[model samples]
Target: MLQETRLIMGMPITICIAEGGAGARSMAEAFGYFDAVDRRFSTYKADSEISAMNAGRLCRDAISAEMREVLALAEKTRVDSDGYFDIRRPDGSLDPSGIVKGWAVRNAADLLREAGHRDFFVDAGGDIQADGVNEDGEEWRTGIRNPFAEDEIIGAVRLSNRGIATSGNYARGRHIYNPRQPGDELDDIVSMTIIGADVLEADRFATAACAMGADGIYFIEETAGLEGLMVNAAGISTQTSGFGAFEIQ
Candidate 1:
């Protein structure tokens, strides 16, 4: 097994590959994918396509194909989630951040798969995508940190050929907002973790659900191929019917 962690996209990008044939080369290529995504879509960098668009220097029709794809996906999530998942801020500026992080991570994982690696894990911050079993011959288990207890692991989820993303206001501090309630802050829910078919799906819904506060769990339960666990400000935990399936024993 080979494991590597590098600071990229303003966060630690950690990757683990099992049965690595050409370890260094494979990991380098994987990281390259992430770097490319960062260069193109990052909101922090002034030269990024996203930043340029926000600055009014780039028009929608002139944007790159990849940017168009991400925006479309963001719109779809907004409509599907009843405007809970939105990239457009209250200031009316476009921001595709809610969709890009998971999309980039998922694409990076795909790069590893195309290179003939099956058992691998890619984690960008808290979002994760894992294929095949772990080095222990079991599904990869990802921890769900307790919102109240910073150092404690309240629970964990086992994922294989799937993805998990946890969105919380505690860490980001009002980073994820609700378009439906533009000015108001979402304070009812502290944490929301989603399990989905892939990283993009999981991450988008997790952000949207977290923005919905306590009502996020109900939306998650009604959605197909998505399960969520929500922790309220009072520390009450609520989950969808299928959420327990991913929880590690």
Candidate 2:
């Protein structure tokens, strides 16, 4: 088993490969991809593509293919979440951070798989895309962090060839807001976690649903092929009917 963790893109990204043949070369290449992503997408960086666009230095038509793809995905999320998942900030600047992390994780997993590493786990911050089994040849056990107490875990889920994402205010603190009502206080729910076919799918919906406050889990319950768990401000957790199926007992 090989595992490495690095602080990239403003978070601790951990990649673990269960297969014995996995090497430093593939791991380096994967981390390099994340570095490139940060350079191109980070709004905090002065020379990043996102910053350049925000500063009006780059034309929309001149943006890279990846930028265009992220923009399209953001727009789709906006529509799918009834405008609650917008990427535009109050200053009219675009911040696609919410979706980019998961997208990056998914791509990194693909890179590892392409390199013939089937049993691996890619976790960017708390968002995860796990494939195959762990070193013990068991499903990856993902612990959902408690929003009220960061060091504590509220629940655990078993996953293989699946993705999970958590959106919340505890770690980041009011980073995500309802675009429809920017001033609305999202005090009802502190965290929202979504499990989907892949990390990108789970992440985009998690961001939107968290912005929905307490109604987020209901939305997950209504959405097909998605399950969610929500922790409210009172430290009470609520989950969709199917979410129990993913629990690790």
- Most lDDT-accurate candidate: 2
TM-score of candidate 1 versus the correct structure, residues matched by position: 0.90
Clashing pairs in 2: none
Q: Which regions of candidate 1 deviate over 4 angstroms?
A: 171-187
lDDT of each: 0.86, 0.90
Please give the distance, in angstroms, between residue 157's alpha carbon in candidate 1 and its true position after superposition: 1.7
Instruction: Tell me the TM-score of each prediction against the true structure.
Output: 0.90, 0.92
Q: Please write out the lDDT profile of model 1 over residues 1-249, one tens digit for every residue.
A: 999999998989999997766766878998998898889988889999999999999977899999999999999999988988889988778888778889998988888888888888999988999889888888898898887677898899889999999898665445443445533443468789999999889999999998887788999999999999998765678989998888887
- What is the per-residue lDDT of model 2 for residues 1-249, given as tens digits with 9 covering 90 to 100? 889999999899999998856457788999999999999999989999999999999999899999999999999999999899999999999999988999999999999999998888999999999999999889998999987677999989999999999998554335443456544444577889999999999999999999987788888899998999998765679999999999987
Alpha-carbon deviation at 186 in model 2, angstroms: 10
Candidate 2 segments exceeding 4 Å error: 171-187
Error of 2 at 27 (Å): 1.1
